[model samples]
Target: MTTTFADLTTMRVGGPIGRLYVPTTIPEAVDLLQRVAATADPLLVMGGGSNLVVGDVGWDGTVIKMATSEFDIDGELLTAAAGVEWDRVVAAAVDAGLAGLEALSGIPGLVGGTPVQNVGAFGTVTSDVLHSLSVYDRQTGQVERWTPDRCGFGSHRQSVFKHSDRWVVLEVTYRLRRGGQSGPIEYAELASRLGIAPGGTAAPSDVREAVLALRRGRAMVLDPDDHDTWSVGSFFINPVLPEVPDSARGCPRYPDVKGVKLTAAWLIERAGFPRGYGTEWGDGTVALSSRHTLAVTNRGGATTSEIMKFAAHIRAGVEARFGIRLNPECDLVNCSF
Candidate 1:
């Protein structure tokens, strides 16, 4: 029996796949990749199946589930292989009395995926700590290190590797501080939860706990028993606009270099799609997570098409109500909404 994406992804929905490779070592992974690169069929060097949505029919190509787990700490510099669980790295940093990665405590997926989305929560972004990365080029068969500038991290989420599938991330190096103190708190909710003023710094362990608690409350952290946690994190990225439109006057927005980053969860809720919105909303298969509107969850036995339809409904509603198109944060694989 072929193990499909349904067996791999956190959402637990997808069809049969021909093969999914989980290499025991980096050399093995590279060897398989070299072989796959010679073929015309699609090549997906996937990490943790967090930010993915495959079609019900499934992918017609090879799926490389990144399995490397090499992580080392030299002074304050933390280097993690592509396959290391993201949260574990955060926990390790906190245990080692490192800072800067505290606010990003509960984020799912692998270290390799961070640069792709510039994953951020509270206020600290991955790029803020990212020093460099190593990637294997399928076209050139050369493994090279990339500086942050070459990655081209954009607002909300976008990178040079994000749109293109040519470069396969091998490992990532993040520059962290050896000091036990946390960075300045930038997210108001997090600061309030921690009983600290905005811009105030706390212990990394305290910040980690606070962040994890906040995530758990929203069901953003993975919980096998909770259906709400069976989601690909936030579905739509907060749309970074050129400027806030006059029509969206009351919408919560933050100023950025791109223009304005409007809160997508707020937009969805305001557009009339609230938390636990489903059943009567769609085919009853997919729904807005009971704990968070940002998560498009599989209620039970939901199909890819059902989820897409439900998302489309939400997107349409938001666009009609606010005149802003919501872009999905979940990376589409052999599927579209």
Candidate 2:
């Protein structure tokens, strides 16, 4: 039987795939890409499959599953291959007494995806410690290393690499602080949990443990037996607005470089789509995670269509209740709402 996206993605949905390639090395990945580029077949490059929502029709093209896992730690600098699991990298950093990645301990996905999404957790983001990354420019058929500025990072989870497959990330290097407390904890809940003031410091291991606990509490961490974890961690990006809307008054808001960021989960719950909202809908195969309103989960035997429908309902409800439109944080493949 042919493998399907449901078997690969964390969502456990989607349909059969046409072709798949797992490259164990950078050269092999490049060679595969070059060969695939010579054809008209569509290409989907995936890391951990944590942030993708594919249609039930499935992909009828080439799918490259990054499998290369190699990394090096030179003092405070850590360099990892694109396919290295993100959490493993964080664990390694913490073990080495590195400080920067401790707050992002339990985030899913791979090293290559960090720069693409500017992955963040309780307080720290990938860009906060990124030194540089190497990418293969599909357009030019050349490999180049780029600094943070060239990545076009934004306050929201965005970069030029996201939604565009022009640059294939090959390796990532992070500059962490050697033997020091983690960068000042910027997230209030995490700080409170650690008994530190917001913007205060904590030991790296302590921060990692706290972050893992926080993520586990919200079902953000992966657990094969838990249906609540069978979804993209956050299905919708926190909506950033120039100013807080009257309707969203008293909702949790944070200052951002672009504007004020409002919690998507807050809007989602207040819009009438509470946690476990879709459990009664359709075949009850998909629903908002009972642990968190931000995650739309696959309870069991869910299809891509069902997931999208549930998400669309949540988005529509939030938009109608608040004047803001919610966009998916996960990439939708071969489907749109």
Candidate 3:
């Protein structure tokens, strides 16, 4: 009766875990990490498990579950423990008449995971409002505070914390506006939904509501009863290229500091792997989310192997059709397709 990763992760598909530890305090988490680091076994520090896909072979070492959930608000400055649910932070900020976080509402995962992925939605990202963060640097066995510049924030979900185990985010501080209005709405879809022009502003509460509704419509929000939400919100990162290739003519493109960012969903659908494409592949256990082409869902009783297999098919198909390889946005644990 060992607990498996299926019980912990949103995807609900990984194999049995060897060991698990839930640290209720930052000090306790650091002590556990030190102990684990002394051993030869592998280590995984998990938050909400919303962005992970583990192999069927399972983890053979230690898994640290961040469980601390304390937060403080000093006027317009909000600081939250790494384990706090991300949506709760947004809701609290809006209730306090603070702006900046409203546009990022409804994103699943913990506060600590936000910096790791630079989580964003609507028209805002975590780095946009981040002031500083406290981290337990395992390499030095010391706690340190780092500014946004030190975090190496980049385009399309890039951050220094991603795919690295050297730092454990303990708390994050966000500087928000005192006024009740949100930042300028730069995303066209969100502006249209709010009945405003792009770059216009709205009440933080209204923006939060609109964001949550949009996420729910796409099955991006977690709902236990909905198979479509039983997956990471997006399986692939939108490829950023120097120039739009001829094969991707007419595909939606956006400007990025590095180059141009192409829509992953557009490439996926055009490659013939439309929404709900894998229903006929393997006993119907896994498929693209019916509401979103970018989400690969566990329909019911799907294995991690099945999920990876389906994802590989989509990646391969897209590459074959467009000569561009799509990379996974989710962190693959002890697994690769």
Candidate 4:
């Protein structure tokens, strides 16, 4: 029986798929992908099913869900199947005294999905610790081990799975540090909350605790009871635009590949889209999160169309004011404006 796409995504909104295969093993998953690719029928590879927004009309193709959620650690390295939850991996790493991922404690979604978007939080991004991956290259129908360089990880992005959907992340290997602490706290707000200097280190578990607490405060942590967490996490990646000097641009900038990443939240706020925008009495079907401007939440019964309209309003408003276009972080399917 096919599972409705709504049952699989965090958004809990989508139509039905022609077929949905929950493969329990890597081989089965690979074979299914190969067969689908050979047929040239459209297919989607899903993980914990976070970070997706499928239209109400649903998908017309097959969806292969990776359900191989095994995770293990040998020495300081960690290996996890694509289906493993990403935040749970962080918790495990912290409990094991592994340091590198502590600051990324509350990120949602699956392990395999981490590399897909270079999932990150606080000051820690996944690319910082990823060492290798076992991937099925759909282009050649071959399974191979790939290094971080081959993955083309970037600011909230990676080449391994972006745009092409040509690789099914079977397993991922992370080179985590042992018995040390989190990498330097690069986020000023986090450091201030922890009472440490910027770029300072904290005990791995402490960092995890602090990060989780901070996330909870911001309503970034997933809590089914909280409608704020019902939406995709951070709807937009901070827009990294061409570097204009502070003198030339008249605002702040953070380092990035081409230039600097401007916080989309900052731009949205500056552009006059405040938190809880478009809501009446602070309650609307589709609302900007009260705690964070970057997140668009479903107040209740909000459809993909409503969310898209709100998002489009914000995008146009921001672009008109800041002269920079914002790109959505979630995989927007079947809706175009």
Candidate 5:
């Protein structure tokens, strides 16, 4: 059956797909995924559809929507099918009085997508609690569990699943803390806003409340009626820049990737594209969220081309001024730069 990518994405753009699979069990998902890979049929594996931006022309391949729902909890260790909503997982952990996930309470998308991009917020990343994973490896056609080290988690990314459409996450295991409020506060802004001291602890529910409040204030929380949230969270990962040398300052020098990470939003604001940059919905067809400089929104009706064009404009403007190229945080669907 044909389904529009627009309907499958939070951005509300894109075209259609040739095929769609909604597997409800492990064997079924693995079987279909292997078949597609073996037959050389292009495939797109996705979760909550909260972090994608498909092209307007549509994907000419099969799209697998993981729907498996089996989940079990044992003490502080929790294993969930990839189909489970990430936020729901957090809620369950909270209900169980677990503490490690409270800082990540409001993030959208499914559990499987968490490890894919090392999803994080309020200074806590999924990698921090990851213990193991059940993944379908396309190369060996093996379904197996992987340790945290095996996942190759770095800042905002992982190694096991990057740049390759190979492994399909089936289930994930997390090691959560027991009988504690939450981790020590590490984000200055979050701590300040909550009137809590840095490195201090608070109830998990309190932490979640503060995070949701902050996200809502910035329009980072999803709202069906707010076009400002018609985005893929932060558009760019903060750029890590090498220390500036006196010689390089005379010319243009991008981040060395071995130095300190610079905030992309800070650079954008410095580049003159403050929050709510660009014409309402003209030219780039994308607008900076009026509440947050980091998000690029689809003003009513926008194509992937338009959104990307606006992104390019921001990247260019930032590079011209700071000599740093902001890499996008969202995965590009059927489009390349």
Candidate 6:
């Protein structure tokens, strides 16, 4: 039987896939990739599928799911294969008395997706802890180790492999500190939750719980029972603009190398689109997550078109009201704004 993309993705949308290939071992993965690369058919490399929005037409290519779940921790070094659960990696690091990854707790997706996006939360990013990666180079058909500097990580959600099909991550190695304490808290809300001043520290386990709690409140954590959690964690990447418009004087701003990062959720709220926008307005198939302004959720039986329409509606609203356009953080598959 052919499996649908809905069966594989978190958003639970998409049509039937042409073919699905899951490689459980390293040799098998490399060989499969090489063979696919030599073919004229298109290919889609899928991880946790947490960051995807697929259309009703679905993909017309070979869908390769990274299924190798293997990991090893030696002293302060942790090695994880592409398919290992990302949260599981954080938990293991904390359990082993490591500190670097505790702030990233409760993030969805598999381990390999981290470096591709330079995944970050709270104050730390994957690049901060990553030592190296075992990548299968599609161009040369060779497997080699790549260092952090080679990944081209900078600014919000980017890397050499982020949108490129030339490099496929097979495994990742992270360098962590051998302390039981969490890294210095940088997020004000998280710091307040831990009852610590900004820049203060907490135990790793404590940090994990606190982060998870915060995510749960925003419906960022996955929960099958909650309609609010039925969307991608955040629909928009916080827009980094050169300057804040006079109309958006009250909008929150953060400094970034790219310029000024505007708070997307704040813009959405200020634009008159509050949380649960669709439930109260249009067809109930799609709506803003009840807990998070940045989330565009599927209420029930919502099609990918509904999600895109709703997202475009939000983007257009934000632009008209604030003079800033929001970009989606989720990976759109066969779907466009």
What are the runs in model 2 whose C-alpha is more than 4 Å off? none
TM-score of each: 0.97, 0.97, 0.97, 0.93, 0.93, 0.97
For model 3, how does the per-residue alpha-carbon lDDT over 102-218 read when each residue is reduced to its tens digit? 988888889999999899887688899999999988888788999999998887899988978889999999999988588899888889999999999999999999988888999
Which segments of model 6 are wrong by more than 4 Å?
A: none
- What candidate 3 gets wrong by more than 4 Å, as runs, is none
Q: Write the per-residue lDDT of candidate 5 for residues 1-337, one digit (tens) a residue.
A: 5688778777777888878999887789999988887786788999878777888888888999988887888988998999888888998988888889988978888988998888888888888899899999888999988887877676445456756778889999999988877889978888887688898888888888888899899988888899888888888877665565332344333333366556678778878898888765466457999999999887777888888788898998888887778898888877744
| lDDT over C-alpha atoms for residue 113 of model 1 | 91
Alpha-carbon error at 98 in model 2, in Å?
Answer: 1.1
Pick by lDDT: 2 or 5, better one:
2
Clashes of each: 0, 0, 0, 0, 1, 0
The digit string of per-residue lDDT tens for model 6 on 15-71 reads: 789878999877888889999988987888889888888888988889889988789
**lDDT by residue for model 1 over 1-337, one digit each (tens)?**
8898877887878887766889866787789889888887788777888898889999888889998888999998999999899999999988988887988998989888999888888888888999999999987998888999989886668788888988988899999999867989978899999899999989999999999999999999988888898889999998999988887888898887799999899889998888999857656778889999899998778888888888898999999998999988988887788
Residue clash pairs of candidate 2:
none
For model 2, give the 10-residue run with minimal summed lDDT: 117-126
Candidate 4 segments whose C-alpha is farther than 4 A from its true place: 155-158, 245-250, 281-283
**TM-score result, candidate 2:** 0.97
**Lowest lDDT block of 10, candidate 6:** 5-14
In candidate 5 the C-alpha lDDT for residue 240 amounts to 60
Candidate 2 lDDT, 137-214, residue by residue in tens = 888888899999999887789899887989999999999999979888878999999999999999999999998998
The whole-model C-alpha lDDT of candidate 6 against the native structure comes to 0.88
